[model samples]
Target: MAETVFARTPRLVWRAGTPDDVEALYAIVSDFDVVRQTETWPWPADLSFTRSRCIVTASDQGASGVVCQGDEVVGYLGLSPEGKIGYMFGKFYWGRGLATEIGAAAVAYAFDRFDWQCLEACVFADNPASGRVLEKLGFEEGNACQGPCRARGGVYPIRTFRRPRA
Candidate 1:
């Protein structure tokens, strides 16, 4: 049997997402409330397992981990293909500091494993909670701009943040 290694926090575990995690991942991300602050996810997210599989399998470019509390997948955090930092947790897990913990771990992993000098993040102007997460993780706010938020089906103002590897 293969052993499963996990990145951990006081109350959560983080591990590389695999194809086996697709269902659990979909369950978390498919919740409209869970992704309402996101820029890319469609409101009625394409509930395709294949799409989820692609996300899990593409973690080779950067770090990607499923945030868990015991066996339940509560969220995910990772660097995107474009090298930006991103994360999302189940609505139930919000306000518990899980995103901040996961963000810290992912940032450390990215700096250790990749040659990138810095990582960037963008949060919708309306979602200050996410902006706070980035701030807590040492990401400094940068210029604001307008971006298409597929979930909202319109262009919305967004604020960008960046964290340089120390």
Candidate 2:
């Protein structure tokens, strides 16, 4: 809930996520392709409104925002409670530069609105696209490690990245 109007890209608007957005949010994150590389999304995707509500509520407390394309919620860009930055978009929006737009908006918000000196992100080793999004936002590559990917149902290689406040 830092600021409702987080940022604006050419085709997308970044705004804070709200409880009412659960349905639209669910549509994006529930897609197997979207959550496959993530750490928290459940595998086989529960596809339940209850789960999406919980996620929206939790994200609402931090710098979480919905990525909108002309009045439609297309994705999410947010900072976790632990200060890590993450995003998810509907598969239809992929490869169209939406992630980069949202990522840059989230990075600016973190540095300008919060006291944290640095922000971190972790991308699955197999997900080079996500890694590129972080890199475009100025996140420097760091150590690589193994982490539990809930959707994958096993440990997966992860690449860590960090960006310090300017």
Candidate 3:
């Protein structure tokens, strides 16, 4: 594996995923709304389907993190080999600037540890909070695509954003 990006924000520590983390990871990722927001898949219970997804996730992605605020795992973030980073927070932990703060650390860590020149994120148009966080973190909005972006259950505009090289 390549070097993992460990992000340290004021409120959270973002670290890579492990086999041991499946349970907690499952809890966060399986949240109905959160899953729907980030994925193009159906709502899944903790059965073989979800387990396989987790196993393959461990195999394919080099960096996965158990997001921790001290002793509690608040959320998770991932950096793909292609330089795309996906993130989500626990529903209870939202609206506290935690996402942007974690995003800042993740972005910085990606730039520093991976020598990445840029990073990209995809957000459903309905989610303004995500867009604002990306913009506040200096991600420039890109073109939008009309999509049935799996989660929304209908065709809608999908906006892309990117953080350019400094």
Q: Please report how far candidate 3 places residue 49 from its true position, in Å.
A: 6.1
Candidate 2 per-residue C-alpha lDDT over 82-109 given as tens digits, one digit per residue, 9 for 90 to 100: 7799888889998999999878877887
Which stretches of candidate 2 lie above 4 Å from their native place? 1-3, 47-61
How does candidate 2 score on lDDT?
0.79
Task: Choose the strongest candidate by TM-score.
Answer: 1
Task: State the TM-score for model 1.
Answer: 0.87
Candidate number of the best lDDT: 2
Clashing pairs for model 1 are: none
What is every candidate's alpha-carbon RMSD to the true fold?
2.3, 2.9, 3.5
Q: What tens digits encode model 1's per-residue C-alpha lDDT throughout 59-81? A: 45765667788888888776776
Of the pair 1 and 2, which is ahead by lDDT? 2
TM-score of 2: 0.86
Candidate 1 stretches with Cα past 4 Å from truth are 1-6, 49-55, 58-60
Evaluated at residue 24, the lDDT of candidate 1 is 83
